[model samples]
Target: MKSINGKVIWITGASSGIGEALAYELDKKNCKLILSSRKEELLQQVKNNCSHPKNVRILPLDVTNFEAMPQKGREAISFFGHVDVLINNAGISQRSLIMETDFEVYQKLMDVDYLGTVAVTKAILPHFVERKSGHIATVSSLMGMFSSPYRSGYCGAKHALHGFFDSLRMEHEKDGIAVTMVLPGFIATDVAKNALKGDGSAQNKDDDATKNGMPVSELAQKLIKAIEKKKMESYIGRKEILAIYIKRFFPKLLHKIILKSQVR
Candidate 1:
């Protein structure tokens, strides 16, 4: 694996779930980190748990605050002089049917899960270009590869990331910018518990699939490997990942199976 020691990496949504796990995983490599989230106190808690707490700077950020990203990005750059890697792991999930879901919920999903990431990346792109080196990693989901029950908006947002980042990779080769689209199947995270319901309220419960999926630490390690390899894209998790291939090679079969599954 490529050594990330002493590299400066910035992670959004650093308070919990995959983001928190990534911080811990990278800390072992002696990386300098900037942890960001809307909750400053929680971010501090994560920083405290890192291998070198003194080296981990906590930056409270809300990716959904599109207008604030330029300033936040500048602050991030100033904190560490420069960022070697930017991990976009901040996103919201949905657990609502398309027809019944509120239009506002869809807007929020696009705003937070899709455009929010675009905003942050655009804010930092100039720095990466000037340095002629950087890695951009986004935490996408299996839902991004194909549609699933009660996740229409969430899937839409993730699918958009695939398009945007793939195009970014196509255009930024000379700039030495690498983009890794990390598509995880399901890791034991609070995503489902905090997922948006049809009315735009938190889902407030866990899904069986997520509860039974790969551990977050395991997912974080796999993600680090992919990022170090500068992989264009990668998938993580157990059986859920196989569904991506099935959907690709046998659309009808995958559709039938999805319809019969207990996703909701």
Candidate 2:
């Protein structure tokens, strides 16, 4: 197993939720952290909460600003001279039916969830290639592997990540680069509250499924374990994770079950 202790890790979306939890967890493991998000103030808060605050650096980044990612990547690498791992956790969710959703909402979802990740990965890829070592771990939802009502855009964006990252792994395996796709079923966080509506507005309210999802701390532990083991794909969640297998062998039944669940 790969050891992350003493490794410099960069995490986008570090202002809250899974990213914030990861900062605390990794700090406990003696990992150097570079935390990024559009919310610099919140990133500072997360940094201060860490046990080894001195080892954490806050780098504010807006993932949707595609053109700025290369510079951001350079800055991230400069934090401790090199980044050993990049956790692509910056993403937004959708909470509207496809018909009701505006075109811009879909565009925003693609920009933030799919292309933004591609941009950042491309930014740091050269460094990884040159050093012949690196790990790319992304937080993709279970929705990426199957269909769900009101999450059409989210599913599409996440699915695209799998395709792109899978190809990256294949093309760069000889370079000693590692790729891990983290498929989370659900975790108690503000994802639903921050999800976009049909008109590209934040939902601003929590849903039942999300409110009762796995705790963020538990997910963080599992995520670290997946990274340490260098897993190509790790599904973390409750019963919702079964959807991946069901979608593979019993697609029709999975569809019926999803519909019956009525999880918004």
Candidate 3:
């Protein structure tokens, strides 16, 4: 649409990082918000910081709970009649070499990043289809576009999202639905620290590059502009964002750079 003003938006993973920044940014635009995350307290904190506090509501949820998604969808719709936009920003990251990674660790990444997103999308699709109008924007990663070391599972999950959402866009184009896949490079978030390790434990610390990446608010602002314009996709970051372009025209050069880069 033209702007987020007065439109009802549902954002998952609103407790922090990009999701929280989005809530604040859109709130300033007068958008009504339904924020969800596993941490209700943190979600509330985010809601409190919104420009229009009255326009924000907190709904805690775990995206992996597929069975409960229908009820969650109903609750979300009841809160705002019908959601005009759904931001699927909830996901976890993985940081482990495949050979050293545990199978369960890899599975958890798929469960949280891929299947969880699918579950939320499936839950909301019926409403969008019935109404024949809605926007689905998701936060995938730069790794989704290009592979990286020690992130096999994370890359695989993000790659799966690209495949699934690309197909969804084609299938639902006639239904007046739109899908925007956002590919974010390293932002100043604690995702690296909280990412899953090979033993199913938290990495509990940020990587060097991620720690010094672009500011979250800046990325959030740009992403909001892209959403307002209904752009099909937008890539964000400073240096890392270039990887997506380089991977396209100079695949060999990109591989050589990645091989020598200290991602971990």
Candidate 4:
């Protein structure tokens, strides 16, 4: 098992949602954390709420800016001496139809969700390689495995993550680096309200699925457990987890049910 206790972890999207929840959970376990987000003030607030505020350092960063990742990664290493885990959790969701979605919306999705993550991983690769120890964990979605309506762009990005990280895990395992992919079902967060529409505008409203999703804090706890176990891939959430199996074994049936779902 790969224990995170006392490990230096750098988490993107740490200002809100799952990242924020993960911070609070990991803080209780005595893990040193570096929280990154576009908002410095919000990151500071999350740090304050953690068990050991002093142990949490805020590194404000926008993942979409690939060019800045190297400097940011250096800043993180300088702050903690070394980072044991890099959690690529900073991403956006989409609630737009494929045809109606603007080209720029898809571009933005790929930019932030796929390219941004890969950039940060490349930036931190040197640190982990030199140390011969590190973990790369990503927060993908169940949509990465199974498709649904109004999430074409989001699903595409998540699927890209699966491909990219799976290859990363394969190539880097020999380097003593590990990778874990997390697929989560709906957890109560503002992702829906903040989701982009076909016009590249915010949906600005939560859907029924998101409104009734599980609490984020619980998801964070389970995520940490999976990381501790060093599971190559893990799923967290409600009955939606069954979809992965269903999609693989009963594709037609899964398609029928997903069509009936109000995921949008």
Off by over 4 Å in 2: none
Worst 10 residues of 1 by lDDT: 1-10
Give lDDT tens digits, candidate 3, residues 87-160.
99998888888888999988888988999999998888999999999999999999998898899999999999
On a 0 to 100 scale, what is the lDDT of residue 147 in model 2? 77
Per-residue CA lDDT of model 2 for 1-264, tens digit only, reads 367888899998999999999999999999999999899999999988999999999898988898999999999999899989999999999999989999999999999999999998999999999999999999999988897999999999999999999999999999999999999988999999999999999999999888999999999999999999999999999988988999999999999998999888
Candidate 4, residues 95-207: lDDT per residue as tens digits? 97788999999999999899999998998999898988889999999988988889899999999999999998988898889899999998999999999999999989998
TM-score of each: 0.98, 0.99, 0.97, 0.98
TM-score of 2: 0.99
Highest lDDT: give the candidate number.
Answer: 2
Runs in model 1 deviating more than 4 A are none
Worst 10 residues of 3 by lDDT: 44-53
Instruction: Point out the higher-scoring one by lDDT: 1 or 3.
Output: 1
lDDT, model 3, position 235:
95
Which residue pairs of candidate 4 clash? none
Task: Score residue 61 of candidate 2 by CA lDDT.
Answer: 92
lDDT of 1 by residue, 1-264 (tens): 277778999999899999999999999999999998898998988998887997899888888888899999999999879999999998999998888899999999999899999998998999999999999999999888998889999999999999999999989988999999999987899999999999999989998888988999999999999998989889998888999899989999999998998576
Superposed by TM-score, candidate 2 places the C-alpha of residue 179 at a distance from the truth, in angstroms, of 0.3
Q: Which stretches of candidate 3 lie over 4 Å from their true place?
A: none
